[model samples]
Target chain A: MTVLAVAEHRRGDLRPVSYEVVTAGREAADATGGDLHLAVIGGDVESFAEDLNREGVDAIHTVAVGEEFDHGVYAQALTQLWADVEPSLLLAPNTVNGLDYAPAVAERLDIPLVTDAVGVDAGEELVVTRELYGSKVETTLAVDADRAAVTVRPSEWAAAEGHGDATIEPFDADIDESALGARVTGFQEVGGGDVDIGEADVLVSVGRGIEEEDNLDIIQALADALDATVSASRPIVDNGWLPKDRQVGQSGKVVTPDVYIAIGISGAVQHVAGMKGADTIVAINNDPNAPIFDIADYGIVDDLFDVVPALTAEFQ
Target chain B: MKVLVTVKEVAAVDDEFEIDGLAIDDRYLSYDLNEWDEYAIEAAVQISEAREDVEVVTVTVGGPDTEETIRQALAKGADRAVRVWDDAIASAGLLDPATKATVLSAVVEEEDPDLILTGVQAADDGFGATGVTLASAIGWEWAAVVNSLDLDTEAGVASVHRELEGGVEETTEVDLPAVLTIQTGINDPRYASLRGIRQAQSKELAVQSLSDLGLDAGALDSPMEQTSLYEPETEGEATVYEGSAEETAGELAALLREKGVGEA
Candidate 1:
């Protein structure tokens, strides 16, 4: 059993998840007693391969194709590489770009595909653990196949450390430019507004629990009372109750405030990814089982409607 | 021009629910249109509204119970709906992305739409791979996690903004006859009006079986099998305050003040 993990890069720098995927791949390789191979495609492959040659990596394959990620190129390159390496298990980060091409590669290769895996056991059969229904429940899936592809969620495994001596090779993939249909044009930065939630000292974040746009007045009042900037989960911003700059999540701003009070937020994984670095985290929600409590340092399992007014009065 | 939107009926679990076997109890689960698909439908309808002779058809892979949800797409703006379901599909333990792409590819063959749109991932399964997999299965171009789309039918290209991590977006140009997985907040999905609801009742909502789409039970066969399902053990070590709202608020406020939160 051989494990091949693919590294991801955007712009000139490799994403952090690339290192985490190495750790995941190493673990899977250890379980199967197989060599762990890492591949970095596109953008400065030489430097990326050297950086990805972390502990437990046996070999590094670099494919210099494009500067940035293009799914068509990725699908073609990975599919061709799959035929060359013939690894039993292929691992990639469950990032946006990974999802863009990993599935197509899996389809072309005709293998079982699993995404967003938090846990992987590659003993007799590959078993993957993932969340469902907004992380309310977790489920484990078994891949009953000889070959499989799995995308590991970011931050689940620590980034691999220490250096290793690995054999590096450049694989020349036949990428037909005429066959590619999608082309990367440019990149843009969004969520630009007056408020920079990332620099706030205190944040009063809200979520769908606020119920209606009119009810956002209470949240604003609470933010005012605490003299803190108002931030929100995706739903509030999606509903137009708050601007995109004030949104906190994976796709939004990652904020590490001094004191972060989560009101009515259930702390979905994406939301927690942004605010989990806060110095002090507090959650106020009606549901005790809400994932917000899992990461909160202090929690009040009560109605946000009743608690917000009282908390506001306390600061006032 | 025809735009095909992939719609799904997702089951949202209640705040407190019981796991009956490999799924949440039916009584605790409420079915509704997938959040991301709402934006997909809205994007397709917006295109249809702006262009002439644009037929927006929604395709769903669900049972009869999902027609009500499919009708919601019709009520919003879709011209018609196609639902593919059969006993073999129901019996299939888990329809992984590959299996789903195989099933949907058949529908794509029959419909031959100029453009196909789907949610980035279903709310229930959250695989987030079906659209791109379907694109590869059918040998079409694809863009995933697309938050903005600028369609130029004459140019045969769709300029899209794929939302990346940390507020960065990558703009790309995809050739026509592509599959785009729509992300939320791309558009404001409209509420179905009374007149629209009345109209949707009479609109064509055709149900197709595996045979109807030139597929067989083999299309539903998947290499992935769900072994177990359960609620994850809560890893919370938070010091939960037990009291009235005022008391808890006082405790939290004191902690915040001690942390120098409101001093500024």
Candidate 2:
């Protein structure tokens, strides 16, 4: 069985999640004793091929569509490439571009697709583990198809690493211009001036338990004292206490910081999905039964008003 | 303009689930419309209210218990609802995503909707594949995680902005008769009013089974079977910090220093 991993890129640059896709593909390949092939589909992705030379990759196929992340072009290209390679398993990042084209590719290829894969194993039978109910429960599935297409969730698998001597091959796929009807016109940043919590090394994330808009000053002060960035759950943003950019959850930006101080956050499944990847999590909530404590590295059951000022002074 | 909005009912996030024989224990679990689909319903209603000659319809695959959920959408302003269920499918076992998409696409073919809307993913399954796959099965242009949408009925085109990771929103123009999976925070889903609830009792809710749609029971046979369902393992149990607010704060700061957070 040949396993193909699709590399995710933005414009000409490759995204970090591409390596995770490779890791997922490598795992499937190792389990099935199959060869692993990685593909990068974008204009000027040759350099990306060199960057993607991970140790377990058997070969790297670079398809130069000579365009930005065009959905139609990607679907057509993958379909053509799948026909050429006949891969038993196809893996792609469960991202904006990947989800856009993966379904169409699966349809065009007539392959069963299992998406948002958190855990997958190719044993006697193919099985995958996925989260449901906002990450509250896990469901395991056994795919009956011999050949399957899957989208691996971001931050679930560790990014692929180490160097390899895999040969880079340029793949030419037949492009159908008429099918490329939808066009990506532009990209805009929501709440442009807000801090990007995704890039923060340490985050002080507030939640609904923070009470009201005026209390945000205390959280901001704590962030300043710790020299960390400020983010929040959906309620904070929905309440207009913080900009949407500062929100972290399933609907918001996913962040993987070194230290995540979840102050007054109740740790809802959607909120936890975004920050669960943090190296160290410290949740401070008055509610001892808060689900955030399930995954928090450290827990503090206390009122934010009393804790925030004390923590701010201590950090200072 | 005819619109088809898809909705799903899922266990609440805080609900603890346990295996009751073959299925999860539902006695203590409360169900509501999936969070993302609420936004889809709201988007459908807003769009319908904005344009003249627009009607919003909803569809879901569920047993008889799903009628109340369907009625919730009707109260929220959907013109009609279709419940896709058949005794043959229920007896055959759980339906995989491909089968669900096939069933939904059959409904789409019957409705021939100018627009199809579904949540980015159901909170229950979290596969997030049905909308895109349904679009593929029916041969329609589609976009996922759409936060902003504008439909130009006259030109048969829809302009949408998709929310991507890292705070980026991509604007794209898709032709009408397309599918859009709405993201959360697109709009606030309204609570059903007393009048709307009373009026929903008389609204058109057409329940169609697999055979009714000319789809065979074999089509609903799921290739994927659930081997297990359980609470996911946690990496490590949380270590609680004890003291007064100030003392605990001091301890936390010292721990952060030891961990080398913030260049300590």
Candidate 3:
């Protein structure tokens, strides 16, 4: 058995989550006692492949296509590569690009696929755990198929580390031009005037507990005093209180800031999935049983309306 | 041009969800259109309103009560509604995302719509597999989790921006007859008007079964079987600080300083 991992890159550079994909593949490969092979597919991605010389990797396959991301090329390349390698298990990031093509690749090859897996175990069959019902429940399914493809969620698995002298091999996907039905034209930032919370070092986030749009002024003030960027849960964005780009959750951007201040947020599983990587989490909520408190490094079980103002004044 | 949008109705479980064996207790559960599908319906309606000779049809697969969800889509501006249900499929156990896609692709073939749209993922299953799988099963180009969409009917192409992780977006252009799985916050979904709801009452909601579409019952089989369903284990336990609002803030600020979080 062989485990093939798809490395993700953006703007000709490898994203941090790519290593997690390798980590997932390493686990699968170890379980099956198979060699682990990683593939880096993009324009000028040769250097990106060098960054993935992890201890468990057996080899790296580089496919240069002179484009950052093209759905048609990606699907075609994966399919063609699968035909060549015929790996028992395939792993990819559960990001936007991976989801766009992973399912299609599975359908094209007639293989079983599971997306957004947070837990993975291999034995007689591949067992994976995924969330359902708005992230309120967990369901574990066993994939009995011989061949399976999985998209591992970011931040769930530890990034693959340690150095290895894996053999580097250049492979040509040899994708047919006629098979390319879609082409990437350009890239656009969402809302032109949106905050990039994913890159923030310190974040002061709000949620439905902020009450109304007018209440945002206080939260903004606290963020300003702390010199931190302001982000929010889905309700703030849905109600137009905050920009969608500022929303942090499973459906939104994943952030791993140095410090995350969650104010009045109940810490729904959907929201927690994105920010679980924060170095330090501080939660302020009146409800003692709110799930957010469970994950918070420090918690204040009091009304945020009173606590937020005091915090702002203290910071000032 | 005809557009087919897939919609699903899901139970709204509040705090303290009761799980009876493998399924949640539906006694206290209320039903609503899957939160994500509302964005898909809104996108379809916006396109239909902008383009001439375009009709938006919403479809779902479930029991008879699921028609309420389809009617909601019709009231929101869909020209027609459809429900696909068979007693046999219902009794065969849960329909996996693949099976759901197969059933939906059959409907797409019957309708022969120029475009098919659905939410990025259903709120219940959150598999995020149906739309893309349907596109593959039907041999159509597709883009998932698209935040922005624009179609040039004359040129037979659709341009969309897919929302990626880390706040980055990639734009792509797909040939006509494509499937787009819409993301939330693309646009504010409109509320159904009173008159539109009245009109929807008289509108026809066609129901189709597997036999009607000439699909085999085996198509409903799921490749994977769910062995267990349970609540995830909670991670770190919290150390709650009890004090007045000002005292709590003071303690929190000191802790942050020790942890090297906020500016000191």
Candidate 4:
């Protein structure tokens, strides 16, 4: 009876989403009265186990094949591993790759699966909380199972700090040549110039409020003056004005920046899905009724074009 | 070259959308062609459009109600559409993604398409499994989140543009008859033209049953049950900006700096 938290990574670096899963897994294991086990499935990702171990987990399971990024390879390997571990609660970060494999694992095992769970509680039945209606609702779910699985939403739980001896155990599986399904051949990271939303301490995010697509220079200038990273609501990403990587929302990345300055954003639920975790949220929008105001720790109900230049000069 | 594009229909995203227990209000939920599936349709449409020899066929498992989605795919330029009719599919014990992949792989075997396309994830379920699962069952090559694609029909090669973190685009060329799940930013979906819509009305969309694909209706046991559904909770307050750009910038910089945002 173990709780498995699958660690997500890129290259060799552990993604912040994985930490979120750790928090969620810790919660699940506590509820289920099971040991929490961290699982890493990337090539040369052994080092990540040590870092994940620092979060005070019991053990780190490594399937450190170079083919970690391959979806089918991952799904089949995890399925075989689950057979060996038989975790009472299986956890993964609700990410693109995680989504790809978790359901397949559920189907292969014929187990109950809950995805994108924002909260978890144990009892006679394992209760999970999920955000519905694009973060407008939090739905409580009670699963009928002794063993269940889920993908944890990012930023829902705090990543535990401090260290424990997270022992690493290597799991070997029969990964046939055909099982890989797709070879990455190679990979290219998007927007090499900007810091990721998950890593940024401070963020000056733009929404539709910046007006014209060309008007983004002001937000860019603000990011520069602040030495802050730039993130955006979904529209900016969908419109191609900003890279998809820059967009923050349910579909995009969820970030927990130190201070989030939302420029001209109306704070739609989809938009807030990305920035809700910021420590201090400052919203600058013309419309007072905009939902962005609902979450702002401090707000300025003024036209953005008027406000941006003053701030740029002030920061300068 | 035959290419299969799998798409689905789901509840529209709304700030007001909440699951009232087991039921959802489809009225307030505006349905469009599924957003992630749009990428799949675009991939197929582009392949067939650029390469004269490539044939794109779209598939989905739904009832008479989902015909609208299949027609929209035709407007986007898929040559034909297949609809597998099964209300049981929703509750039939088979995982929605795996079952769909099983059915899809079976269909593809008959059509023998070189390429298969599906959205990276379904907007409604967000399960994101059909493409890879189908590829695995069929034992074919696959790529995911491919933002750009250029097809070489003659050489049976596909050059794909992949999006990565940090704003980098990776382009790779692979042999034909592979599967690719499209990233959201691949290309803007083409609106169904009146002509295309009219043509779609007459196009042949073969509807099959779960058994037709050799899948038992009750192959899966749902491990989770929907105990309750409710609206998601909104956190915090909205901030409205006022005043001139200069004045606001001044106030904004002060606020930002206080938050450790501004360097100067």
Best candidate (score: DockQ): 1
Q: Higher DockQ: candidate 3 or 4?
A: 3
Candidate 1 CAPRI level: high
lDDT of 1: 0.92
What candidate 3 gets wrong by more than 4 Å, as runs, is A191-202, A215-229, A249-259, A266-279, A285-291, A300-316, B241-264
Clashing pairs in 2: none
lDDT score at residue A38, model 4, on the 0-100 scale:
81
- lDDT per residue for candidate 4 within A192-219, as digits (tens), equals 3455677988888898767678999988
User: lDDT of each prediction vs. the true structure?
Assistant: 0.92, 0.84, 0.85, 0.72
Docking quality level of the chain pair in candidate 4: acceptable
Task: Measure candidate 1: CA RMSD.
Answer: 0.9
lDDT of 2 at B144: 85
lDDT of 3 by residue, B1-264 (tens): 999999999886665667787777887478999878999999999999998889898889978989887889999999998888887777776576678878898898899999999999877777787888888899998998888899998898898888876556788888878999998877889999999899999888998889998897888777788888886676758667888999999998888777665564
* Tens digit of per-residue lDDT, candidate 2, span B1-264: 889999887766443446665466767577877878888999999998988888899998887887898889999899889888878866876566677888998898899889999998876677777888888888888998898999887887889999887667889999878999998777878999998898899998888988899988788766678878777675549988898998888888888888776564
Residue A42, model 4: Cα distance from true site in angstroms: 3.9
Model 4 chain B poorest 10 in a row by lDDT = B232-241
Name the fnat for model 2: 0.76
Give a tens-digit lDDT track for model 1, residues A1-316: 8998999999999999999999999999999799898889999999999898889999998999999998888888888888988899999999999999999889888998999999999999899999999899999999999999999998999999999888999999999999999999999988588889999999999999999999889989988988999999999988887888888989999999988989889999989999999988999999998999999999999988998999889988
Q: What is the DockQ of each candidate?
A: 0.86, 0.56, 0.60, 0.38
Top-scoring candidate (TM-score): 1
CA lDDT, candidate 1, residue A166: 84
Number of the top-ranking candidate, with lDDT as the measure: 1
